[model samples]
Target: MRTRAKICGITRIEDIHSAVNAGADAIGFVFFPPSPRSVTQEQAKELIQHVPAYVQTVGLFVNASLDEIEQILKQAPVDILQFHGDESPEQCQQISSQVGRRWYKAIQVKPELDVINTIKSYQNVGASAVLLDTWHPELKGGTGHSFDWSKFPKLDIPLILAGGLKPDNIEDAIKTTNAYAVDVSGGVESAKGIKDQQLIEQFMQGVQRGSAK
Candidate 1:
């Protein structure tokens, strides 16, 4: 199957068009306020307008309450919800069901952790997919740090390789992990929350080359 690409942390309408025009299957919007890439419900509503049909819109939340998510959905109803915080499998399922949307759970990959079991726990609970990302003590994601690709194992569900992915290394990442998809934010951006069109194109090109192998 072809590897899918999701361009995340989108802040501007131009970025949305850039990502879509560059063949991104999905566009992400951050709902968490602490991150510089975060966008308000209003901003997401306007930005999502530029996204054409068949290109998914994803909302990233960091331990947001049900009320908060519901309220945000009122204005900007994203196609998928990505839980990027310390949420349990039960919570992820609960919130996903309540919100009436499929969800992807982000796993912070570290050397000491039991990668297979952890991924299985979320998979058993019905996550649409598992996104493997670099682990950090304080930060949730967008760390721009990569974990050991050799640590990856064959899985039953679709795995989305994230963290530290850029035009330079994306091909190797895909070949090594054989990930069903890839998620990128800062890697394709000229600055925080601002995506570079040229970089986006390069990243997509890398994806195509990787998938071909």
Candidate 2:
């Protein structure tokens, strides 16, 4: 019931302030060029300059090369990295070791997904936590498609629920998934990449209201 929240796909400076003001524990910037919310490393760095301490700056990526990841580390001071691609355990471990810190990996869960198997698949990958995100099958996250909540049984690892989570459904998603955290991207946006402050607040409130139960 007690779960943290992360709002991803931040493209504008005002949205960053809005998320922090709304009490989001973390804010994610999309580094994947294909995503509408994508930002350049320089832009990401500038956006993070005024981000207060205690609020994590998470960088989300697809299948990026290690060199590219290194470039990001050199350019931006991110607290966390979120790998949303088909990266192997060895690769994830390598990236964490390279960065001198642990990071999160997203597991694409299809309909009728089994939580146990999904957790095991990533446990050996040295992921700090496993995120249950919708798999578009053709795309890597940011699709706005969600998996069935009934599909997730019980999970043991630190779980962050994602995909199609918005003000209308976030509360129900958290209550049903029993996740340790909830991640929202396209859900609270006015468009593909633009974030709406009112929606962000309402979504966060919905999650809080649901957890109170």
Clashes of 2: 0
- In terms of TM-score, the best-performing candidate is 1
- lDDT by residue (11-110, candidate 1, tens digit) is 9999999999999999999999999999999999999899999999999999999999999999999999999998999999999899899998999997
lDDT of 2 by residue, 26-145 (tens): 989899998778999999988998689999889887878788998888988688889888787678778878877678889888656665775776677777788888878688887787
TM-score: model 1 vs. ground truth: 0.98
What TM-score, over all chains together, does every model reach?
0.98, 0.94
Q: What CA RMSD would candidate 1 show?
A: 0.7
Residue-level lDDT for 111 in candidate 1? 66
Worst ten-residue run, lDDT, model 1? Answer: 110-119
Best-fitting candidate, measured by lDDT? 1
- What C-alpha lDDT does candidate 1 achieve relative to the native structure? 0.94
Give the residue spans of candidate 2 off by over 4 A.
111-115
